[model samples]
Target: MGNYQIIATAAMGLEALVAKEVRSLGYECEVENGKVIYSGDESAIARSNLWLRTADRIKIKVGEFKAYTFDELFEKTKALPWEKFLPEDAEFPVIGKSVKSKLFSVSDCQAIVKKAVVERMKKYYKRNSWFEENGAFYRIEIALLKDVATITIDASGQGLHKRGYRIDQGEAPLKETLAAALVMLTNWKADSPFIDPFCGSGTIPIEAAMIGQNIAPGFNREFVSEGWNWISSKVWDDARMEAEDLAKYDQPIDITGTDIDHRMVKIAQENAIEAGFADILQFKQMQVRDISTSKEYGVIVGNPPYGERLGEKKAVEQMYKEMGQAFGKLETWSIYILTSNEEFEQFYGKPATKKRKLFNGFIRTDLYQYWGKKPPRQNEMMK
Candidate 1:
C-alpha cells in the first residue's frame, strides 16, 4: 500500500487529455509523450483503471535506468524490487521494444529481462527449480528509448478502449477511447442537444451519454490486476461503489445518432441498448443532406467517410459539399468533423474555425471545429 509510480499510457495528441482526466481523479500527473506518470498507492491503481477515460492502459513503473549492454540490462533489472509486485508461481511474461538503443535486438532484450526477473524471483521466494507459472498474470514490458529502459507491469489486461459494449460493429468502427476524446474536446453540455451524423456503431453517442451521466467508462470491464493478492479487493470495491454513487442515471439528455446506412443505424441502436442508453438516445437512418433540426445552440459531431480510395474521392467530395449546404442552414449549431482529406475545407465550402491533428488508429486525421454563437439568456429571450 506504499506509494508506487504509476503510468497512464495514451495515444499521441491525447496525453494532455489523459493527464486532465488523471488530475480529475485527484492524482497529480506529469504529462509526457504517449504517457503520463504519477505516484499513488494500491488504491490509486484501482481508481485509475476504473476512471481514466482516455488512457490506453494503467501500468506500475517498476524501474527506469540507462543500460547499453546486456550485462548492464541484466544486473539493473535483477536489482529492481520485482518481488514487490510478482509472487512465486506468478505468470510473468516479458514484452519489449527498443528504439535507437545499443540493445537493438528486441527479442534478445526481452529474453535478458525475463531471465533477470526469474533470477530475482528465485532469490526472493527461495525456489530451486523452475517456476510452474500457474498463478495471476503479470505482463511486464520493457521500453527502451535512446539508452534508457523503463520497466512496467500492465494492470489493465486489455486495452481500456474495450468498454464492454458494442458486441457488433461495422467496418472501421471508431475506438471507444477516441470517441470519448472527441466528445471531451467539444463544448457540448449535458443539458444541450447532441448528434452524431456518422454514428457507425454508436460509439460517439454512447460515449457522450456516459459522459453526460457521469458514468465510469470502465465500470463494467475487468482489469488484470483485479486478481493480484497484494492489492486488497476492498480498494476495487470502494472505487466501484464510488462510481455508482457519482453516476447521474436520471439526468435528462437529448442525444441522437444517425447514419445513411439503415444497417448501421440498427447496429447503433443495438450498441446503445447494450450501453444502457436505449431509451435515452435516438438512432435514425438518414443522409447528411436530410438532417434537419430546429433546436438552437445544439452540437453536431461526426466522423464521416474519408474517401481514402482513388475512385471514391469525388463522391466523398460531393457528399461534403452537400453536408456543408445542409449544415449551413443551422447557423446556431456548432459543428465538428473528423476527416483525412487535405482539401476538406475547400469541399466543405467554409474554412474551419479551428483544426487539430489527431490519429484515428493509424490514420492521421484532423478535427475541424466550427464554433457557434452562444444562446441568449432566458431573461433576454423573454424580453
Candidate 2:
C-alpha cells in the first residue's frame, strides 16, 4: 500500500523511549511532546502495533493544519482525503480535545469535524442517503493545540496496554506499558535474576519474562486495523509470523515476584499464568524486608507505595527504611525503585548512584537507582 504518516501516542515522559523503539523497528521518527511521528506503509502499522511496548496507541495522521475559528476547522477538516481511508460503510466516530487553543469548546469542535468528514465522505462516495455506519470501525480524533488542528484515525482500538493477560489487578496496579518501560530502563539480562518485591498483579515480572523471551508485547492482542480492507491480511500475517520467529520460547529466565499481601500474590500468579509466563516466572507472598538472594549481579525493581495520602506517609516512610536495609545486603545486585517520595534517599540511608524523573500516571515519581559493582567474569566467578 501507499506510505502514510503514522503517529504513536505515548504517555508523558515516555516519548523518547517510544521514539527509540520506533527507530529500532528501522523507521526514522520525530519525537514530539506526547507522541512520535513517522512515515511508513501498511505493514508499518502492523509492525508498530505489534512491537511498540511503551506507546499508548497507534494512529494514522490523516491531516493537520492551523484552525483558529469554527469555519476554518470545518473547512480544513473537510478538505482532507477521508475517502482514501474510510470505507462507505465504515463506522466513523469523532473524538475531540482542545488544549490552549482559541476554539476551546471540545463539543463544538467535535460536531463541526464530524459534519465536515460526513460531507467529504458523501461527496466522494456520491451517495444521497446518510451513512449507516454499520460496518468496520474507524475512530477519528481531532486535537487542537495552540491553534493547530491535528486529525488522526485510531488504528489500535483499545489502548496497547491491554495485552489481554490482566484479568485481575490490585488497588494501585501499575500499567503494562509503564511496567515494560521500567524493565527496559534497567540493564537486566535474560540470564540474570530479576525480582520485583512489589509486583502488584505481576505486571513487572511478567513483562520481564516477555522481554527475556523476546516476545512481542502485543503478540496476544488484536488491533482494529487488522480488519481494514485497505490493508491486506498478508501484511499482518507476515508481521505476526516474524514476531513468532523472533521469540526465544525456550530461553531460560530467572524472574520472581513477591508481595506482602497473600491475595495480591495469588492475583499475580493468576495474571502470570494468563500471560503465558507461569512456568518461567515465580510469584510468592513475602514482605520486602525478608527478601534475600544468593544470585550475583541480579536486578531488583519495584513500584512501592508513594504514601501520597496524609495518613499513610509515616508508615510508608518506615517501609522505605526497611526496604533500604533489606535490599542493601545484596552488594552485587543493582536495585531500582520508583516512588513519588522526595525523601526516599533520606529514609533509604544511602544516596542513589543515579536517578531519573518519570511519571506514574499523573503523579511525578523518580526512579532511584542503586548501582552495584558488576560481578566478576565468568571464569573468575566459576573459580
Candidate 3:
C-alpha cells in the first residue's frame, strides 16, 4: 500500500503526549498546534484508532492547499481523488471546523468542500448525487491556518476517549482520555501501586489498571475507517490482532479507589468490571482523612471534588487539608492532584514540585505533583 499522511488530534496541552503515542506506533510524528502530523499507510491509521489512548481522533490528511478564497478552496479540495477514499454510493458527511485563518467561514468552507468532493465523486459514479447522507459517516475537519487549508478525513468515528467501559457517569466525572493522559503524564511504572482517593466513577483507577495491563483504550469501539471501502477487512483484522498481541500481561499490580460516597464506589466497581480489570482493582468506601493502608511505593492520583459542588469555602478547605494529611501519612508514595481551585496548593501546606495545565471539560485545571521521601538506597536495589 502507498504511504499517506495522517493527523492525530488531541486536546490542548497534550500535543507532546499524543506525539509520543503516535511515535510509539513507529510513525514519524511532528507535534503541531493542536494535533500531531504523521506519515503512515492505511494500516497505521487503523492501528492508531484502536490503540491511541491519549489522542482525541485520528484523521488522514486527504488534501492540503492554500485557500485564501472560496474558489481556491473548492478547486484544491476537488483535486483530491475522492474515489480512492470513498465508494460511489458511500454516505459522506462533511463536518467542518475552522481555526484562525483568512477563509474562516465554517459554513462556506463546509459547502465548498462538500460540493468539491461530491463533484469529484460523481465522475467516478457517473451520477450527480446530492442527497442527504444516512448510516455511515466521515467527519471532514477543514483547518485554514494562516490561509493554508489542511483537509483531513476522520478515521475514528467517535472520539477515542469514549471508551465503552464508562456506562455510569457522576457529576463532573473526568473523561476517559483525560484520565488516561493524567496517569501517563505521571510516568508511573506498572510496578507502582496506584490509588485514587476521590475517584468519582473510577476513571483514574480503571485507566491505571488498563495501562498497567497495556490494554488498548479503543479495544471495544468500531472505527469509521472500518466502514470505508478503501480499508479492507483483512487490514482491520490484522490491526486488531496487532493490538491484542501488544496487550501486555496482567501484572499483579495494586490499584485501588476510595470515595466518601458508597454509591460512587459501587459505580466505580461496575466500571472496572466492564473494563475487564475487575480482578486487579479494589474499590472501597473510605474518606480521604480515614485512609489507612500499608502499601508502600504507590502513587496517589485523583481529580478531587472542587468548586461550588464541594460546598462552602470552609468545607472545601477542610477536604484539602485532610487530603494533605493523607499524603503526609504515605511517607514513600507520590501524590498527583488535578484541581481547578487556585488555593489547593495553599491548603495542602506544601507547594507541588511539578505542575502542568490541563482541561477538565471547560474548566482549566492544574495537575500538581508532590513527592514523598525516596526509599532507602538498599530498598531500591532489594528487588
Error of 2 at 69 (Å): 1.2
lDDT of 1 by residue, 39-133 (tens): 99998999999888899999999999999999999999999999999989799999999999999999999999999999999899998888999
* Model 2 lDDT per residue over 1-383, tens place: 78999999999889999999999999999999999999999999999999999999999999999998999999999999999999999999899899999999999999999999999999999987799999989999999999999999999999999999999999888999999999999989999999999988999999999889999999998999997989999999999999999999999999999999999989999998899987888988999989998888999999999999889999999999999999889998999999999999999999999999999889999999998877668548877
The residue pairs in collision within model 2 are: none
Q: Which parts of model 2 have CA positions greater than 4 angstroms off?
A: 378-383
Q: Which stretches of candidate 3 lie over 4 Å from their true place?
A: 128-136, 308-311, 377-383
lDDT ranking, high to low: 1, 2, 3
Write one digit per residue (lDDT tens) for candidate 3, span 178-276: 999989988577987888899889999988888888888887878878887667888889988887897886577888899999999999999888988
User: What range of 10 consecutive residues in model 1 has the weakest lDDT sum?
Assistant: 373-382
lDDT score, candidate 3: 0.84
Q: Which window of 10 residues has the lowest lDDT sum in candidate 3?
A: 128-137
RMSD of 2: 2.1
lDDT of each: 0.94, 0.94, 0.84
The per-prediction CA RMSD against the true structure, in angstroms, equals 1.9, 2.1, 2.3
